[model samples]
Target: MTELLYLFDDSTECTASVLSCLPTGDGLYAVTLDRTIFHPQGGGQPSDIGTINNVSVVKVVHTPEAVLHLTDHEVAGEVVLKVNSEKRFLHSRLHSAGHIIGLVGDQLSWHATRGNHFPGEARVIFEPQDPASVKLVDCVQFQAQVNQIVTQAFARVLTENNGIRTVTWGNLPAYPCGGTHVKTLNEIGQVEIKKIKLKKGQITVSYALT
Candidate 1:
């Protein structure tokens, strides 16, 4: 099994070190590693972009057990892979921000259905149960409180309960989430709810970082 570096009990950069590389096909290779902090394209978040052995990784796809990094060209030696920390941090911030908004909606008696992360130009969409319950004024109030919570520098505690990853936002919202998140809410910084939609008794709230 592959060891996830991010799963470790430490605060460090989200990167990984290559352990061994073996040819898999004519133009493809399977690179194994000791540990990796790269949060692969899972939980609706996109995979990271960066270099591996000086060759740019075109894509990273997550599987059941390992995240495979695919490069444009084949390599022949020990390689160094550096994750785009900017992208990683952006995703982390947006993800946690989404969690905060989602939790707030739930507190308002609005049942959230699903959430997704749009990286680079980060965005989070939340499907609420009662469309009539969502209001522009309350949305503004929710965002203000969310920002305040982020400013508190709350830590994200991940725990395995019943074979699932639990992502707890601060001490307020603790739920099962398999996605990656920033260590603290303060790292998420400021967030804004750009728009909201209503249809079929369902409210959709969209958010962005400013």
Candidate 2:
């Protein structure tokens, strides 16, 4: 099993021993390391791209067995691992913003059904207990409330129980998650609600970072 270094601390770079380097078809190689600071693609967040022994990492994926680092070239022995700091910061901001949006949905009596934190496509889908109860005007109010909460700059906290990780912000409701996040909500910058759509029994809120 590969040790996920990012879960414990926010180290941007580390040197890890290469366990195996296998060709996964095409010209790509799947490199496995003893440990990694890379955050694999999961939990609605995209994989982190960086370098492994100077070879560019195209993607990172977590399997039941281990974490696989996809690279264009092969690597061996002790490799220097580094995560792209800019991409990591953007991803963390987008992901943490999504969680804040989820909390807002809870305040509206809606449960978050799904979410996407991919840069330009970031959004959260909520399922209201009663779809008819929400109105178009309510969406505007929701956006205002979320922005007020963001301005509060609540500190993001994380804890683990029985191997399950949970994320909570200030007095907001806590939720299970395994994604990277900023230390505080203010780091998320300004959140703009791009659009809101309510259909069937679901409400989709699309947002962007300013």
Top of the candidates by TM-score: 2
Please provide TM-scores, in order, for all candidate models, with all chains considered together: 0.78, 0.94
lDDT of 2 at 180: 90
Sequence-dependent TM-score of model 2: 0.94
Q: All candidates' lDDT scores?
A: 0.67, 0.87
Candidate 2 runs further than 4 Å off: 131-137
Candidate 1 residues lying further than 4 Å off, grouped into runs, are: 9-34, 76-78, 120-137
Q: Write the per-residue lDDT of candidate 2 for residues 1-210, one digit (tens) a residue.
A: 788788867898989999999999989999999999999999889989999988999999999888999999999999899999999999999998898888888877887889999999999998885766764426578778878877777888888899888887777777888889888878888788888888876889999899
Error of 1 at 155 (Å): 2.0
Residue 60 lDDT in model 1? 66
Which pairs clash in model 1? none
Local accuracy of candidate 1 as per-residue lDDT tens digits, 1-210: 557665443333334556555665767565656665555676667776666766766556777767777666765444566777777788777877778877777766666666777754444444445555554336687787678777876777787867777887557767776566888778887888776666655667778888
